[model samples]
Target: MKILVCIKQVPDMESRFRPNGEKTWYDESDLAFRMNEYDEYAVEQAVQLKEQLGGEPEITVLSIGPERTVEAIKKALAMGGDRAVHIRDDRYYQKDPWQIASMIASYAKGEGFDLIFTGMQSQDRGSAQVGVIVAELLGVSCATTLVGFSYDGGTITVKRELEGGIKGVAKLKLPALVTCQLGLNTPRYPTLPNIMKAKKKEIASLTAAELTGEAELTATAAIYPPAKKGGGLVLEGEIGAQVDRLMGILKEKTAVLR
Candidate 1:
C-alpha cells in the first residue's frame, strides 16, 4: 500500500506574534517553527497504518513552504515516514486555499497513492479547506474529521465524529483522501536512534514553478489581532439585590435565564 501524508510547517503558537510593518504577516525574526500540531496526528496515522500493514507500505510525507520547511519533514521521517517531498516557495503564505490545494493536487495527480492524509485544519489560518479541495481536484473520495480508520485489501473503512456525539461510518474505495482530527491515535515521539537515521533519509526538493500555475483565490487586505475583551461587571449591593441583577444579566445572555 502507498500512503501520501500532507504536512505543514506553522509558526509555534507559543511564539509572540506581531504583524510586520506592512501588516501582512507576523515578524518571523527569531521565531521557531515546527510541524503543525494538527498535522502531527495525520503523520502518526500514516506511520501507524504502515506499521500495521506489515508489508512495508510506502509512506511519503509532502509539504509546501520555504526551505526551512525541511526541518518539519525531518521530524515526520524520525516518526517513521519513508521519505519526503518539499514544495519550496517563499511566498506560500501569500497563496490561498485553492492555490495551495492545486499545487498539491498537481504533484499528486501522476503519483499512484492509495490514500492521502492531511490535518483537519491548520493552526495559523484555520482554513480547514485544503484537504477537501485537494480531494476534489484529484477527483477521489474524501472524508474529514476522521476518528476511526481501518484498512482491508483495496478498501478502507473510516468513522468520523458529527455534532452531538454522532459517529458517521463509511467505506471508501482506494485512492481516497482524508483529513484527520485529533483523538484518532496517540502520536508517538521520535527516539534518538530514529532521529539520527532520519538525517540519511531522502528529501526530494521541488519548486512552485515545477508544480502548477494557479493564482491565489483570496487576498489579505489587512491583519490584526482581536480587540481586548471587556472587563467583568461587579455587582455591588446586598445579597437579594445582587441576585436580582445577576438574573437580569443572565436573562440578557440567554432566554432560559428567565
Candidate 2:
C-alpha cells in the first residue's frame, strides 16, 4: 500500500509574531518555522499506518513552500517517512486555498498512490479547507476529522469525529484522502540517531511551474491575521448587582437587551 502525506511548513505559533509595516503579512525576519501542527499529526498517522502494515508503504511527504521548508520535510523524515518532495516557488508565499489545492492535485494524479493524508488544518492559517479541495481536484473520496482507522485487505474503515461527542464510522475503497485529527496517535520525537540519518536522506525538489502544466496561480492580496483581543472582562460589584449587570451585558452582546 502506497501512501502520500501532504505536509505544510508554517510559522511557529510559539514565536512572537508582528505584522508587516503595512499590516499585510507577518514579519518574516524574526519568525521561526515548523511543520504545521495538524500536519504533524498527519505524519504521525502515516508512520503508524506503515508500522502496522508491516512494511514501509512508500510514504512520501509533500510540501509546497520556499527553500526554508526543507527543514520541515527533514523533521518528517527524522520521524520516518520514506522520502520527501518539495514544490519550490515564490508564489507559494501568496498561494490561496484554490491555488495550493490545484497544484497538489496536479502532482498527485497518476502517482499511483493508494492513500493520501493531510493534517486537518495548518495552525498559522487554520482555514481547514485545502484537503477537501485537493481531494476534489484529484477526483477521490475524502474524509476529515479522522480519529482512528482499521484496514482490511483493500477496504479501509475510518472513525470520523462529529458534533457533540458523536463519531461516524466510514468505509472507503483504496486511493482515498484522509485529513487527520489530533488524538489519532502520538507523534514520535526524533532521536539523535534518526536525526543523523535524516541528514543523509535525499530531499527531491520540484518547481511548481514545472508541475504537470496546471493553470497559473491566481494572484492574491496579502492579509495578516487580526490582532488578538486582550484578556476577558472581570466583573466586580456586589453579588446581586454583578449578576444583574452581567445579565445586561450578556443580553446586550446577544442583542436580547430589549
Candidate 3:
C-alpha cells in the first residue's frame, strides 16, 4: 500500500505571538516552530497502519512551507515515514486553501497512492478545508475528523466526530482520504536510533510552481489581536447594598435593564 501523510509546521501554541509590520500574519521571528499537534496523530496512525500491514506500506510524509519546514518533515520520517516530499514555498502563508490543495493534488495525481492522511485542521489556519479539497480534486472518497479507524486491505471503516458529541461511521474503498482527529491514536516519540535513521532518509524537494499553476483564490485582509476590554468592577458591602448598586449600574448602562 502507498500512503501519503500531509503535515505542516506551525508556531508552538505556547509561544507568545505578535503581528508583523504589515499585519497580514503573525511575525515569525523569535517564535519556535513545531509540527502541528493534530498532524502528529495522523503520522502515528499511518505508522501504526504500516506496522499492522507488516511494513509493506510505503509511507511518504509531505509538507508545504518555507525551508524551515524540513524539520517538521524529518520528525515525521523519524516516527516511521519511509521518505518525504517538501513543497518549498516561502510565501505559503499567502496561498489559500484551494491553491494548497491544488498543489498536493497535482503532485499526487499519477502517483497511484492508495490512501492519504491529514490532520483535521492546521493549528495556524484551522480552516479544515485543505484535505477535503484535495480529495475533491483527486476524485476520491473522503472522511474528516476521524476518531477511530479500521482497514481490511481494500476498504477502510472510520468513526467520525460530529457536532454535539455525536459519532458517524463511514466506509470508503481504496484510494481514499481521511483527516485524523485528536485521540484517534497516541503519537510515539522517536527514539534515538530512529532519529539518527531519519537523518539519512531522502527528502525530495519541489517548488510549488512545479506542481501546480493555480492562483490564489483568497487574500488576507488583516490580522491583529483582539481589542482590550476595561477592567472589571467590584461591588463591596452588604448583600442588599451590593444588589442595589448592581441594579442601579445595570439600569444606567443597559437599555434591557430599563
Candidate 4:
C-alpha cells in the first residue's frame, strides 16, 4: 500500500498575535511554527496503518510552506513516514486553499498513491476544503473528518464524525482521500534514534511554479477583526413605548412572527 499525508506548519496556538499595520494579517516576526494540530492525527493514522500492514506500506508526507516549515516535515518523517516532499515558498503568504490543493494534486497525481490523508482543517485558515478539493482534482473518492478507518479486500471503510453526535460510516474504493479528525488516534513522539534517522533521510523540494499551471481561483480582498458584539438593549421609556420599540427592533431583525 502507498499512502500520502498532507500537513501544514502553523503558528503556535499559545503565542500572542497582533495584526499588521494594514490589519490584513499578523506580524510573524516573533511567531513560532509547528505542525498543524489536526494533521498530526493524520500522520499518526498513516503510520499506524503502515505498521499494521507491515509489508513496506510506503508512507510519504507532503507540506507547503516557507523554509522554516521543513521542521514539521522532518517530524513527520521521524514519526515513520518513508519519505517527504516539501513545497517551499518564502514569498508566498496568501491563503488560497484551491491553489494549494491544485499544486499538491499536480505533483501527487503521477505518484499513484493508494490513499491520501489530510487534516480536516488547517489551524490557521480552518477552511476544511483542501483535502476534498485535492480529491476532486485527482478524480478520486473522498471522505472527511474520519475518526475511524480500516482496509480490507481493497476497500477502505471509515467512520466520520458528523453533527449531532452522529457517526457516518462510508466504504470507499482504493485510491481515495480522507481528512483526519481529532480523537482518531494519538500521535507518537519520534524517538531519539528515529529523529536522528530522519535527519539523514532525503526531502525532495519543489516550487509552486513547477507543480501548478493555472492561476488561483480567488484572491484576498481585505481582512480585519470582526466587530465587537453590542451589549443587550436597555429600555428607558413607558411600558407601551418600550413594547413598541421592542416590536420595531424585532421586526428590523426579522425575528417577529409575520
Best by TM-score: 3
Question: What is candidate 3's lDDT per residue for 51-101, written digit by digit as tens?
Answer: 999999999999999999999999999999999999999988889999999
In model 3, the clashing pairs are none
RMSD of each: 5.3, 5.8, 5.8, 7.9
Stretches off by above 4 angstroms in model 1 are: 233-258
lDDT of 1 by residue, 1-258 (tens): 878999999999998888878787777787999999878999999998888888478899999999889999999999999989999999888888899999999999999888999999999988999999999999999999998988888788999989998999999998899999889888889999999999999999999999878887798888887786876897896999999999999999988866
Q: For every model in order, what is the number of clashing pairs?
A: 0, 0, 0, 0
Off by over 4 Å in 4: 21-24, 230-258
For model 1, state the Cα shift of residue 126 in Å: 0.8
lDDT at 45, model 4: 88
In candidate 2, which residue pairs get closer than 3 Å at backbone N, Cα or C atoms, i.e. clash?
none
lDDT of each: 0.91, 0.84, 0.94, 0.89
Q: On a 0 to 1 TM-score scale, where does candidate 3 land against the true structure?
A: 0.88
In terms of lDDT, the best-performing candidate is: 3
Rate residue 140 of model 1 by lDDT: 92
**Model 3 regions lying over 4 Å from their true place:** 231-258
- Say which prediction, candidate 2 or candidate 3, comes out ahead on TM-score: 3
Tens-place lDDT digits, model 4, residues 185-204 = 89999999999999988899
Question: Rank by lDDT, descending?
Answer: 3, 1, 4, 2
* lDDT of model 4 at position 96: 81
Better lDDT candidate (1, 2): 1
